[model samples]
Target: MRRDRIAAIVGIAESDIGVTPDKTVLQLQAQAAVRALTDAGLHTRDVQALFCAGAWTTWTNLMLAEYLGIQPIYTDSTNIGGSSFEAHVGHAVAGIQAGLFEVALIVYGSTQRSQRLRGKVPGEVSLTEQYEAPFGLPVPVGAYAMAAMRHMYEYGTRPEQLAEVAVAARQWAMQNPRAFARDPLSVEDVLASRMICEPLHLYDCCLVTDGGGAIVVTSERVARQCRHKPIWVLGHAETHTHHTLLSMPDVTSTGAAVTGPRAMAMAGIRHDDVDVAEIYDSFTITVIVTLEALGFCQQGEGGAFVSGGRIAPGGSFPMNTNGGGLSYCHPGMYGIFLLIEAALQLRGDAGMRQVPNAQIALVHGTGVQLSSSATVVLGRD
Candidate 1:
């Protein structure tokens, strides 16, 4: 049955990837949507399903449909923070399998940087704020700071190990013409940078930029007519361990532990089959924790696993080939870009940063302050 069912990515693109104050979020979303549809050799009228997420607009799904003049029979606007788009991929595949929709469009856009809109801070809605916010718990970076400290205390995960993740991302960024941060970086350089929160230097954080990206998913029947090679959705799974940092069962571990193995199993492959990985890197600690959970290494061995140029540009395991959120554009939710890059790698279209004959790619997205996670495995036909 798994072999009989198939959903493939037929098109993908990005719009206004860097700072663009002139473009509103909806404009960015529309731009990416039209471009992605064009990439798939499709028009707005061909889209039967739509999915979008962001605080850029209320009812983001409806706004995108209206802007594109599309009337979709199915729509999804689920907002799970950074992992929303990866979850969208899983949903779109299920939609195609169930005959709910033939062609689905997933779009995302955010002006968090050029427009200086960080959206609502996480508080007052969860137990974290009820008990943790009173103590002035700075969201995201601050929460990640706590995780970094804990990882160090538990796994002997040094600040230097954290720096390797950032350094590797920048190395890949230098090869990306669209990357936001392409400057040379090293562990020593990262260590020398100013510290925002304890143990997390400036380089340990992800970039802030304005960007919009989109991907078109369709059943194999429609994919056969697309302009580009179809990147099949081999398997995928989504999971969330907690809504807030305080509620997290373990800072050193994440939902990737559950989603990764489940997705890999569904894909019928081992970790070694993946030619590249596109794990979310909102923070350096995110990459380390996620890699460990995904079975890349033992629980506390992420430090050693990512070290010694293992995940670097020319390393054995290519990761974040589009520079990831660390050096690439991070317009609020970054999961969309992860999917875009994975599809590109599998299609053998990733210029400069392309992994040689990359056949299988793994994409993982971390949501909120490392509370939610989603893993999707993609392959070329």
Candidate 2:
């Protein structure tokens, strides 16, 4: 009934995530795509499908397919804010199951920090303008700031609780050489940092970075011959609770509340089976809210769940081992990084950051003030 699904993530690659002043967006995408193809031990001619996403750049599937010198039997250019990459994975899976393509490549690149590309203005009233942009909120930090303030008022979530997320992420980053923010931080450090919005300090937010990442997916039969073991996509789902933070019924919970169970059920996995988690951390509050919605803890226990050394390196749950968006490079949309980290861990390629016997992983992406949500269950075959 599930269409006898067979997909394998054979390759993963990324450029330096923090500051890439030397390369164009296309160059970055090409580099990651090439690296992924090499990792899979496949040539460019083997690809039959292509998918891409971005805001300021014209990321066309055809252009990439042509650049890579492959004739795609199918192509997708779905762009849904920050959740685009995660959504792309679902679309690729559906396309593969429908017999539309045998192999598909998903790629994303951004130059926001280096190129200084200002995304579509929040207030610009075009058909493409986001509804929330009409209000004074333009950037993601402002929208998330509103939610953080509400959590503080309603659940008595403290600044230290928020700071704890940053602190834990930084500690993990120190162990990851590719992580951009390896510096140690404290609650006092976060509190003393510059204020982007009330109750949301600079350290509470993610970094604006320039980078790219890509992954290759193919039928399970073809994956057996690849260079590495396939990280199977056991289950995946995407949902939207609200298009804007203002319309959210409750900012405390996320669309993950709806999507998480569906994905896990599809995979026939329980919460206890997940050995690693790569939850997106666009803002400190984002991770806290997702933890609760994903059933890591009770509705309002996110503060206490992360209070002790639980999410740290040697804690009960080792999260964001490559550092999350909180400590890793956030090149505009950071969802792709989560997928890369999850796949690497399942493949046991995470080196010193590797969790012991990581057999299953849960990777989540939060896009546009928790407007769009995606969840994926990955397991080792």
Q: Provide the lowest-lDDT 10-residue window in model 2.
A: 122-131
Model 1, range 1-381, lDDT digits (tens) per residue? Answer: 133348999999998888999998889989999999999999999999999888876877777788889999999998888999999999999999998899999999988887776534653556345766667766788889999999999978899999999999999999999899988998999999998999999999998899999999999999999999889998899988787576888888999999999889888879889899999999999999999999988999998888888999899989999999999989988999999999999988889999999988999999998888889999886
Candidate 1, which segments miss by more than 4 Å at Cα?
Answer: 1-5, 119-128
Model 2 steric clash pairs: none
lDDT of 1 at 186: 87
Roughly what TM-score does model 2 have, to 2 decimal places? Answer: 0.95
Model 1: lDDT equals: 0.90
With candidate 1 superimposed using the best TM-score fit, by how many Å does residue 86's alpha carbon deviate from the native? 0.7
Worst 10 residues of 1 by lDDT: 119-128
Can you give the TM-score per candidate against the true fold?
0.97, 0.95
Off by over 4 Å in 2: 1-5, 118-123, 127-135
